[model samples]
Target: MESSFQSENENSFNIYLKDISKFKPLKREEEHDLIIHVKKGDKAAMKKLIEANLRFVVSVASNYRNQGMPLADLVNEGNIGLIRSAKRFDETKNFKFISYAVWWIRQAILQAMSEQSRIMKLPLNRVSTIHNVGKVVSKLEQKLKRFPTCDEIAKHLKIDEGDVREAFAIGSGHSSLDSPFSNEDDGSLLDLIENEQAPSPDDKIDGYFLGNEIEDLLNTLKRREAEVLRLYYGIDCERSHTLEEIAAKYNLTRERIRQIKERAIKRLKHPSRNTSLRKFHQG
Candidate 1:
């Protein structure tokens, strides 16, 4: 049953790719007509646009198939992106459909990969750099039939070597041991890493709640006290809790709260910040 299902999936992908490849590239007049049809609520035109772009989607998705994802799954995700681009395409954007669609395609693929990959989420800035690095590395690998050196990739992407290595490291987390780098049978690369050591659920929860408690404790002070310590550590500089947030909690005017907190702080001892009671005020 599994084999039959796999064969059917493969056959469908091949047929789709063949049909998509046969589409004549749209000329300017043709594109204008399609855009008019789409804007006039023509579903057929929009469907045709998505159909015509499936091959391009596959081409882009192929670059990411090296990330140890199923090729058919990646292509499916990319097709969804193609559909999105078709719907969102604006004729006045002064950009070709291919250029605009590429961003959507990349976003869809990254979102899927991030969800399934080992490292979980990549921050927005890092996702773009990592995708670019993946493209460069795949192209280089195709040309040389081996992984490219960090220096070669850095040169190709016009990024620093350090960033190139870091991006590669993050992207590589997507692959299982069945990927190009492995020759082992005991377990996957991810397995080996997990075997070494990892924090337990209790430890992770404890660390999370401990940080939250510290934040709450910091907020318990007057606004000035919180701001002073937070800024001293680069914490709450942006719209940091106003004096009103603390004052309301203490049932006093902001000025009164500030005065009382000033006195309390002078008498308080904070070992972490190296602040002491004896330094500034008499009890």
Candidate 2:
């Protein structure tokens, strides 16, 4: 699946490269002359230098493919990095241009992650797996006194090593909620999402009263089930908790914890349990 995604990225990038094919690759002698002119504050030389090295920027950007940003954005960030490199490049560095510029490209990619990845989201299943694998990895780290290998992690999780490796790859990247899953895909995850309207003032007041009675409603469930919902929803636990943490606390698999939580929620939806809460709703 991941391989297919990467193939599409490469294909799309090829299409992009073809559009700017006139920017021929720079020869060493040609680069030297361009650098001489660039040192004299020649914008034409600078433009040529930037255009000539875009392929290198794309290659560098591909390294950050799974690092959160889309490949297109990664390339865009790398191009910015390349421009910065061009402006500050020392003619007498006695090194290849790409070797110097790679660091700047990576720095730009990391900076973009810091600025934008927060608002991005991945699918819930991927999120759950990432968290589950992370928890397992942490435990193994402590037990082994070193980072565990994929095989070691697989054994501990009773899953395939490839699955463990894939989880690691996913944990290192963030997919934008609006990004397409593949090049051929027509729409992004946003197509399925609707903007949530904030609660009305009257609704908020009713919710306040409902919160007071929620404890009584929850008490109808089994002790553990009720408490799991409380902890999961952060009713009184300060913040909503991840399944990984909740699983650890209960000494159960994360999947088991999720099942328990889901069952509890399903029970809550029954008309028998939410009768009092329903009265607060107008529509």
Candidate 3:
């Protein structure tokens, strides 16, 4: 029965791949027309736009396979981003739709990986920063013909050297815990490991529930305020952002970003708000 189920799943996946491959990419003019139709609530145009971009999502998701997520799952998350981009796309923009869609696809894929890939979750901001650090290193390597040092990367990003090192460490690929310790048929690494200090399974479960509750509470804030809080606290992501970084992204001054963040925190702490997450709050 298991073998039969596996075969059926494989067949289904293969059919999906075949369907996506059948979608021809849109030409520039055709893409513009589709965007217009989509803005006017044309479901057919939206479907076409999504179909034409499924291959692009696959391409982007492929780069993230090393992060331990299956390719199919990454592609699925990327598709969600593609649909979101289609809904929010500005037709008046000078750039191509694919270019705009790339950011959305990547953001979705990274967010998924941050939330689901590891037993210990990292913030999405840290995941994104690690990706940026890698890009910088690759660019510098091509220019200098050698791998750049952490200091060089820090200098380029205008951040501390320790941050660059930490990003590199966090971005390192994962290894199987059950893998053999050495070539000689010896014991696996899992046999020699110690996790006494790790969180208890029950604690982890409670934290997971609390995380969901916090997400619900965050929905009470306005969109921009929620975004500010998310970025500032690394609520759903791997790392928090500095006020300056948030300010630059939103085209606001650092002080203004700080004020917005504070206001959002106040809303979260207000007694009138939901009380379910009140116990999770720390002084």
Candidate 4:
């Protein structure tokens, strides 16, 4: 199945004849003309314009490869940004398309990075802070011989002291000791630290297993009893309904539904001892 899917994808790619030979840097005049064509709803012109700018997308996408995402995925996301830019590209705005599109491209890539980082299960804001803090720390360390102080880092990054501390704490906590918090790392300081254990896998109560168990348990019930269980736990029943709701569904009084529910619960909780089955008392 996977091989068939790959073959289909390859065939589809072959249909789109990508002429990389005509690909040159889009000059200001060329970009302006393409914008005019795009505004006039010429999709072919837009495609050509985008193709010419694929190098720019690649250049921007390459910067984000360090964030532990596939470069191909980033480029694909950047292409999405490029398309959005073409769609929203306004000539009236004094900005050049390249200039306007750069921000859009970065936004698209960063947003994707944000989502990818969330697989770690950190909060959105915290993940964003981690990236921003790393960038700030890297730049500051490059200029200064030693690591910058927290106050200096905060002031330089234009973020609050609390946020800086939080970012640093999260970064340190997330990172291995071998990983430098800043670009500059003293061997002595690095040696004192130890890598924390990776988080344990989350425990999820398997819904499929629970559902199957419920189905098997329901099979032990009579037809009416099974229907009652289905109504209480299946599509028709969203909540733990009151006897009044169940009674209304079954066209009976609340008292009648109550009696049925109680009987069903008792039978399910404590089966009768007979030739076919054994009694199992439930707490």
Highest TM-score scorer: 3
User: How many residue pairs clash (N, CA or C atoms closer than 3 angstroms) in each of the candidate models, in the order given?
Assistant: 0, 0, 6, 0
The Cα RMSD in angstroms, rounded to one decimal, for candidate 2 relative to the true structure is: 22.3
TM-score per candidate, chains pooled: 0.41, 0.37, 0.44, 0.37
Score each candidate by Cα lDDT: 0.56, 0.62, 0.66, 0.57
lDDT of 3 by residue, 1-283 (tens): 9999868876876788898999987777788899999999999999999999899899888888867777788889999989977976666643457756765677678767765654257777787777778789768966874446667889998888878766744553211212232234343322222222332232112133333444767788899988986776445454445566679999999899878866765665565564444343220
**Which ten-residue region of model 1 has the weakest summed lDDT?**
188-197
lDDT of 4 by residue, 1-283 (tens): 9999867765654443254435876665677788899989999889988898777787888887867776767878888878877866656543346555664576567656655655388887887877787677767855884446667778987888778766654443222211232344343212221112212112231112122333455566688766764554321231223344567788999778756755654565542311112111110
Q: How many backbone clashes does candidate 1 have?
A: 0
Model 3: worst 10 consecutive residues (lDDT sum):
173-182
Q: Which residue pairs come into collision in candidate 4? A: none
Sort all candidates by TM-score, best to worst.
3, 1, 2, 4
Supply the global lDDT for candidate 3.
Answer: 0.66
Pairs with steric clashes in candidate 3: 122-238, 123-237, 123-238, 123-239, 124-237, 124-238
Off by over 4 Å in 4: 1-22, 119-283
Better of 2 and 3 by TM-score: 3
Evaluated with lDDT, which candidate comes out highest? 3
Best-first order by lDDT: 3, 2, 4, 1
Candidate 1 runs further than 4 Å off: 118-283
